[model samples]
Target chain A: MGTEIRVQQDDFSVADEYQQLAQESSCGAVVTFAGLVRELAEGQLDAMTLEHYPGMTEQVLADLVAQARGRWQLGQVTLIHRVGRLALNDQIVFVGVAAPHRKAAFEAAMFIMDFLKTQAPFWKQEHTTDGSYWVAAKDTDQAAATAWQDD
Target chain B: MVKVKFFAALRERLQCAELDIDSQPSDSVAEIRHRLLQQHPSWRRELLDNDVLCAKNFTFVDLQAAVNPGDELAFFPPVTGG
Candidate 1:
C-alpha cells in the first residue's frame, strides 16, 4: 500500500530496500531488480556519469509507479535511481515490488522498468580511456516500452 | 519570458545549460526553438536535429505544442536509463 521513489546521487542498498518491501505482511511475493555499470569490451573504462532533470525525474518515476499500481494489485513498491559518477560495478538503479502473488509482482516490476527506460529523464555518459561519450538510446529499449502497449 | 534548459550531451554541445527567452502566448515549441536559433545562430545544427527531444513544463510535447511565458521548457537527446 506504499510506494517509494527516489532519484539520488547516493548509492542504495538492495537488501535494505527488500526489507522495506517485505514489511507489508499481506504480501507473499517480493521481486527486485538492480542495474549496474559494466566495463566496456572495446577499451579500458573510467566511470559512468548519470545526469537527470531534477523536478521532472521524480515526477516521471512516480507516474510510472502509479501506472504500475493501476494495472496490478501491488502492495509496496520501491524504486531508486542514482545520479552522479559511478564506478564500474556500482549499483545504478533498483526496483522492488511486493504482491500477494508472484505474477503481479513480476509483471509490475517489469512494467515500471520498461516505461522508465524510455520515459524517465535520466541520461548516462560513459567515460572510457580514450574519451567520454553519451550513451545512445537503443531501439530495443523503445521496442520494449512499446510492447507493453499491446498488453 | 520562458525558461529553457538543456541536459546531458546536448548541454555540452551547445555550451549552454539554461537560457531565458522572450515568448508570446501564441508561440509554439517550434517557434521558441526558432527564436533561440535566431539569437544564437550557432545552435541551429544541434537544435534542428530530428532526434532532439523537447518537453514543455516537464511533459514531453511535440514541436507544435503551444507555450507561454513562465513555462519551463527542456531540450535534450533521447533518454538512456533503466
Candidate 2:
C-alpha cells in the first residue's frame, strides 16, 4: 500500500487524480471524497482563509494515512487539503482510497475523512461584509470522530 | 528551550505565532501553559478556553504530556478542517 498527502494553496485537478488512481488496475475499487466551501448561513462571503500549523498539518495528515493503511487493505491513498484564500464553492479537501475491494476502499476513505475533521490541525476563518471570524468546530464533528472508536 | 506555537483564532487573539521559552526536562504541557499564563496574563481568557487543544512534537497530546528541551509545543482552538 502507498500513501500521498499534500497541503498546498493551489487547486488540484480531480480528473488527473482519478486517472492516476485508476492506473493501478489490480485495485478493483477506488473511493474519493471532496469537500467544498459553501455560501450559506452568513449570506454571500467575501472569501474563506484557511490557516494551518505548517509542520503539524502535514504530520497529522500523514499520520491519518498511516492509520488508514493499518485498518484496511489499502493500495494507494491520496489526501489533499487546500490552504490560503478560497472562494465560495471552492474545493477544500480531497480523500481518495484505492483497495482490492469496495469495502476496504470505502471504509478507509471514510475513516480518513472522519479523523481529518477533528484530528487535523487546520482552521478556517470566513470573511463576510459583517467581518471575519474563525469558524467554530462543531460538536457533531467530534461525535462523528468519536463514533469511529467503537468500530 | 521549548518552541511553542499557536494557531487559528488563538493565534489571532494572542497576536503571536511562535515563542521560545526556557523549560525544564520534567516540564509538562500544562506546566508550560501555566507559565505562559503567568507571563501573559492578558491571554488567560483566550488561552484558557475550554476547547483549546494542544500538541507536542506534531502529535495530539494531553496536558500531562511531558516536554523536554527542544520539543515543539503547540496550542490552538479545536480544529475546524474537514
Candidate 3:
C-alpha cells in the first residue's frame, strides 16, 4: 500500500523485506530482487566502496519507483540500496514489488532495477589486489534501460 | 551563484567536491560549463568527455538546459548502481 525506499550503509534482510511486501493481502504476487557484490576476478577483490549523492540519490530512486507505478498496477514497492564499503558477496540492493498478478509484479521489479542501474546517483569503486578503480558504466546496462523505453 | 557539485571519479579527477560560481538566470548548463573550463582550464577533459552526465536540481538535463541563480548543478560519470 506504500512505497518504502532506503539508502543506507547497513545491509538489508531479504526475508524481512519479502514479508513486508506480502503484508498486502490484496496482492497475491510478490517479486523481489537482491544484488550482491561479486569478485571481478577470483580472489582479486578486496572490497568495494559505494558513493552516492545523498539528497539526489534518494530523489532519483523515488522518481524511479514512481515511474514504475505509473506503468504498472503495483500495490506496494520496496527499494533498498546500501552505500559505503562492502566486502565481496555482500548484499548491495533490494527491490520488491507486490501486485495482483505475477506479470505486473515481475515486470515492475525488473523495471525498477533497470532504471535504477543507470539513473540512480550511486557509483561503485572496486578495490582489488591490483588496485582500486571506479567501475565503468556498462553498455549492457544502458541497453537494458533503453529497451524499456520502447514500451 | 549556482552551486555546482561533482561526484565520484569526476570529483577525484577535479579534486573538488563542490563549488559556487557567479551565474545569471539566463545561463544554460553549457554556458556554466564553458565558464568553469575557462576558469579551471584543467577540468576540460573530465567535464567535456562524452560520457559525463549532468543534472540540474537533482534531475538529469542536457547542456542546453537553462539554469537560474541558486540552482544546484551536478556533474558525474554515468552511474553504475543497480
RMSD of 1: 0.8
lDDT score for residue A137 of model 2: 91
Model 3 has an lDDT value of 0.95
User: Candidate 2 — which residues are off by over 4 angstroms?
Assistant: none
lDDT of 1 by residue, A1-151 (tens): 9889898888998988988999888899999999999888875889999999999999899999999998999999999999999999999999999999999999999999999999999999999988999999999999999999998
Candidate No. with top DockQ: 2
Candidate 2 CAPRI assessment class: high
Q: In DockQ, how does model 1 score against the reference complex?
A: 0.88
Q: Note the chain A TM-score of all models in turn.
A: 0.98, 0.97, 0.98
Score candidate 1 by lDDT. Answer: 0.94
What is the Cα-based lDDT of residue B12 in candidate 2?
84
Runs in model 3 deviating more than 4 A are none
Q: In candidate 3, what are the lDDT values of residues B1-82, reduced to their tens digit? A: 9999999999999999999999987999999999999999999999999999999999999999999999999999999997
TM-score of 1: 0.98
DockQ of every candidate:
0.88, 0.91, 0.88
lDDT of 2 by residue, B1-82 (tens): 9999999889888999999988997999989999999889999999888888999999989889999999999999999997
Higher-ranked by DockQ: 2 or 3: 2
Q: Rank the candidates by DockQ, best first.
A: 2, 1, 3
lDDT of 1 at A119: 96
- How displaced is residue A48 in candidate 2, in Å? 0.3
